[model samples]
Structure formats: C-alpha cells, structure tokens
Target: AQTVTQSQPEMSVQEAETVTLSCTYDTSESDYYLFWYKQPPSRQMILVIRQEAYKQQNATENRFSVNFQKAAKSFSLKISDSQLGDAAMYFCAYRPGGGGADGLTFGKGTHLIIQP
Candidate 1:
C-alpha cells in the first residue's frame, strides 16, 4: 500500500516571499509518478507540478518547483514570490506509471494562507 503524508496541516506566508510545503510518501514500486495538486476555494484540483521517478533533474514550472528526494521518498513543493492567488490547499498525489488497479493516493493536504 502507498501513502502520502503532509506534516504541516496549515501554513502562512507573506506576499512576495517563498514557502516550501513538505510531503513524504511510502511506495513499494520502483517506477511511479509524483504530483502536487492545488485546490482553490472553488474546490477544483489543479496540477501544480509532476516528477518522474527516473528523472534526475527536479521538475519546475515558473514560480513552482519540487525538491524530489527519491531515496528518502520525500517530495516538497516550493512556491516562490508568493501571491494572493497562490493561496490554496495543496495535495501530494501518487500513481504508478505502468498503470494498475491501484488508484491515486493523495495526502491530507496543506492549506496555504497568503498574507498581504
């Protein structure tokens, strides 16, 4: 069984600063994909970033980046130049790359609050 854990239940950051959200997972499969999804007030889960287990380089998208530690099974999301629009409930998800009966495992999520 695979599980995702977010140590911090909630976090707050001042506008224009940087914030890193922690995420760790346990999986038996060697090949899989990790994802960070953001859910705003509207409650829609949007893909923030993704990392392939085989990829050595960390994945990044504009102001969003991930520190993927495969050996430790730790994947953290770093949001730079935080803005009010960046506030959301971020979720860490996992799914096998090859596909299987296994469904996407998601963490409890970290609620990010942006302060002006």
Candidate 2:
C-alpha cells in the first residue's frame, strides 16, 4: 500500500513571500507519480504540480514548484511570491504508473494561511 504524509497541519505565509509545505510518502512501487493538489474554500481540487518518479528534474508551474526526492520518498511543494488567493488546503497525492491502478492516494492536507 502507498501512503502520503503532510507533517504540517497548517502553514502561513506573508504576501509576496515564499512558503514550502513538507510532504513524505511510503511506497513499494518503483514507478509512480506524485502530485500537489490545491483545494480552496470553494472545495475544488486543482492540480498545482506533478512529478514523475523517473524524472530527475523537478516539476514546476508558474509560482508553484515541487522538490521531489525520489530516493528519500520526499515530495514538497514550494509556493513563491505567495498571494492571498493562494490560501487553501493543499494535498499530496500519489498514483501508480502502471495501468489499471485506482485513483490517487491523498494525504491529510495542509491548510495554508496567507497574511497581508
């Protein structure tokens, strides 16, 4: 079984600053994909970033990026130039690479607080 863990239950960042959310996972499968999904108060899960286990380079999207350490099973999300709109619950997710696997295995999630 695969599992995702977000150590920090809550995180806060000042506007225009950067904040990193910690995440770790346990998995026996060698091939898999990691993802960071953001859910605002509206409750829609948005894909922030994604990383493939086989990829050496980390994945990035705009001000969002991931520090994916495959060997240590660590995948963290970094939000740069944070904004008030970025406030939300962020979840770390996992999905096996092979076909026929079920949906994502998600972490408990981290609630982000943005301060003006």
Candidate 3:
C-alpha cells in the first residue's frame, strides 16, 4: 500500500521568491516512482517533476526541483522565482513499480497562493 501525505493544505509565496512544499509517503514496494503535479485554476494536472527510485540524483525541471529522500519516503517540491501564474493546486503523486504499472495515487493537494 502507498499513501501520500501533504501536511500543508495551503501555502503562500511572493512573486519571484522561492517556495518548497513538503510530501511524505508510505509504501511497501522498494522500487517505485514519485511525481509532483501542478493544477492551476484551469484544473489541469501538469507534471512538475519526477524521481525514479533507482536514481541517486533528484529530478529537476526548469524552475522546479525535487528533494527526494528515498529511505525516508519523502519527496518535496521547490519552486524558484515563483510567479503569479504559478498559483495553483499542487499534488504529490506516487506510482508503484511493476504490477501492471500502477497508476498514479495523488495527494489531496496544496493550494498555492501567490501574492504580487
């Protein structure tokens, strides 16, 4: 069983600042994948970053990066130079390795508020 937890239900950041959202998970599988997704007001889930269990290096995309602590079962997302457009609901998701390629299991979400 895999469960994702987003302790903070809401967060705020000023434009051009940096913000980091925390995530923790419990999973029995030793190998799996983790992802961070952003959903703006439009309500579309966009992949922000992904980390593979076998990889030692954390994944990075543009201004988004992840701090993946495999043993601790924690994967956090960091947004640098946050923009007004970045304000949205962010979800941390997990996909278990093998077994029919398990689909994503997402966290409830964290509402990101951006102050101009």
Stretches of candidate 1 exceeding 4 Å from the true structure: none
Candidate 1, residues 3-63, lDDT tens digits: the string is 9999999999999999999999999899999999999989989999999999989999999
| Candidate 3 C-alpha lDDT tens digits along 17-93 | 99999999999888899999999878778988899999999999999999999889899999999999899999999
What is the Å distance of residue 21 in model 2 from its true position? Answer: 0.4
Backbone clash tally (model 3): 0
Compute each candidate's TM-score over C-alphas: 0.97, 0.97, 0.96
Q: After superposition, how far is residue 62 of candidate 3 from its true place, in Å?
A: 1.0
lDDT values, one for every candidate? 0.95, 0.94, 0.93
lDDT for 92 (candidate 3): 98
- Candidate 1 TM-score, C-alpha based: 0.97
* Evaluation by lDDT, superior candidate among 2 and 3: 2
Return the clash pairs for model 2, or none.
Answer: none
Q: Candidate 3, TM-score vs. the true structure? A: 0.96
Q: Choose the strongest candidate by lDDT.
A: 1
| True lDDT of residue 95, candidate 2 | 93
Model 2 scores what on Cα lDDT?
Answer: 0.94
